[model samples]
Target: MANSNGSKAAARDKRQRLTAAAAEVLHRQGVERTTIADIAQLADVPVGNVYYYFKTKDDLVRAALSAHADHLSLKLAHLDRDPDPRARLGALVASWVERRDITARYGCPTGTLAVELDKREPDGIDTEVGQLFRTLVDWVAEQFRRLGQPDPHDLAITFVAANQGMSLLSNALRDPTIMIREGERLRRWLDDLPT
Candidate 1:
């Protein structure tokens, strides 16, 4: 029984490691370029062991997306620290500003991944991949609604679109300054909102 329990624990650890490695590789190399071998090597697990955890690449991709969603949720949860909706919105913009270099280099993690999945799998995985953006949009929209915006949903979507645009341009141009400038503009826009 102890041996069986130990084996189960080892299996669980391997599965978690594979998911984490897949997320990193998928974000950096993208789904098209990433392979089971790449993820296995990165995770330090045997290539054949990958099959024991994820039946297919899509399965691994889904697991990676789940991990990414969990991570994003944790980061966004930081906004709850501030009671003011405007302050939370500003902080959201600021978070992006702080990652200007990363965004300029790799683009927005969720946005880029969603585009890649949408292009390749389209109807199959696009919806699941989009949940990352959807959750974010919902949270931002809630903040806008709390701030008494008449069109909170549209405003929230616009905010996400602006951030995505900043990430896209910054990554394309390889210029962190673009993201920083956009962050400033977003903050200014937030400040301009009526009380």
Candidate 2:
């Protein structure tokens, strides 16, 4: 039985809505406090339907993160628009600062998963979060390579750490300024590189 494009689109739309709603719930209430019923209500979908889409709460968490990671990947995957590596690297830094949703009540989904991973056994959710970080780092590294720089992997790791550090600053100060300053430092380093 083949499904029509329209039906598939609608299903995807529903899943996206559900994933977003679940993410919001996890962010606001903390993953430990979030419940499937709460996600269902927030999504305006029936409780049974939530379960139908996701077998368990962990499943919902992974799906939400997958969607979030994919959204970010789509946004910055083109971080190498410029032929110059330095320019591309700068763009990568700027993108993180510009797109960061500082007002997010929930922390980074990947960060949350990382913290949770340490407490619990290895699972799909932990793997998904790891993959997201790796993907982001790889993207950053690609830009560094374009610049003919050394240690692309280390540069990517630094960028990832700096981005996460900004989140902590944003949370503490309730301001996005710290990220701007950090982004400037990143650009300055690229500017100083030997031509």
The clash count of every prediction, one per candidate, is 0, 1
**Which candidate number has the best TM-score?**
1
Per-residue lDDT, model 2, residue 120, is 69
Strongest candidate by lDDT: 1
lDDT of 2 by residue, 77-126 (tens): 56545677667777767876774564333455566557765576766667
Cα-based lDDT at residue 12, candidate 1: 94
Q: Rate the local accuracy (lDDT) of all candidates.
A: 0.92, 0.75
Q: Model 1: which ten-residue window has the lowest total lDDT?
A: 117-126
Per-candidate RMSD vs. true structure?
Answer: 1.4, 2.8
Worst 10 residues of 2 by lDDT: 99-108
